[model samples]
Target: MKNSVKYAVTGALAGAANGFFGAGGGLFLVPLLAAWTKLEERKAFATSVAVILPLSAVSAIVYWFRGGLDFMTAWPYLIGGAIGGIIAGRVFQKVNMLWLRRVFGLLILYGGVRAVLLL
Candidate 1:
């Protein structure tokens, strides 16, 4: 019951962040899932990806309906992102967890720094 509440709260927070930001829910989920569930780093990442897919689809639909999504301008990004995701998915299995964790930490750090500096 306690665990369920924790998961539900985290999931809600992740969904809200993704809905508001267009992306980034995985950032929230990764740490929470890893710590709360004691899931291995790789499994946490893979699980977060699975969880975010439906959240992203729903958010995209809402944005599209509200005239917030510009499909024409986003097509190029979508294509490149798809290619990048495919390559990363393949690479993820080969990468060591230590290196992967380091990279993830760097990215989160960079994002945090960038967000603060941009303001």
Candidate 2:
């Protein structure tokens, strides 16, 4: 497929999952990208991160302009997230993704439990 078609398909797939399951689809995305694209595991992951950055920034900008972002309140978490992202980026390549899948599964389970409880 052409880049445009690939992008459209990826965006559509990501959005479809987002609409149903929220951002946890990112975990789904990494593995799926690996499976779907010609990129290797590390390259696929990097590509996913590259794709996510602009999309997430645009999303945050939209929410911010729409009176959704609480910049002041979001600081502590954002700081921790940045630090964690750096650490994870360094270590993630060394870790086997079988373990990553297991960890992601736990997260999905946790989110499901939280959602059920909050309902």
Most accurate candidate by TM-score = 1
TM-score of 1: 0.90
Model 2 score (lDDT): 0.71
User: What lDDT score goes with residue 4 in model 1?
Assistant: 100
Model 2, 1-119: lDDT tens per residue?
A: 57667657777676555544435446656776876665676676677776766666666676789887788988998899899989999998898977876886798799889989995
Worst 10 residues of 1 by lDDT: 20-29
Candidate 1 per-residue C-alpha lDDT over 1-119 given as tens digits, one digit per residue, 9 for 90 to 100: 99999999889988998998877888889999999999988999999988998999899899999999988998999899899989999999999999988988898899889989995
lDDT of 1 at 48: 94
Model 1 regions more than 4 Å off: none
Per-model TM against the reference: 0.90, 0.76
Residue 18 local lDDT, model 2: 52
Prediction-by-prediction clash tally:
0, 0
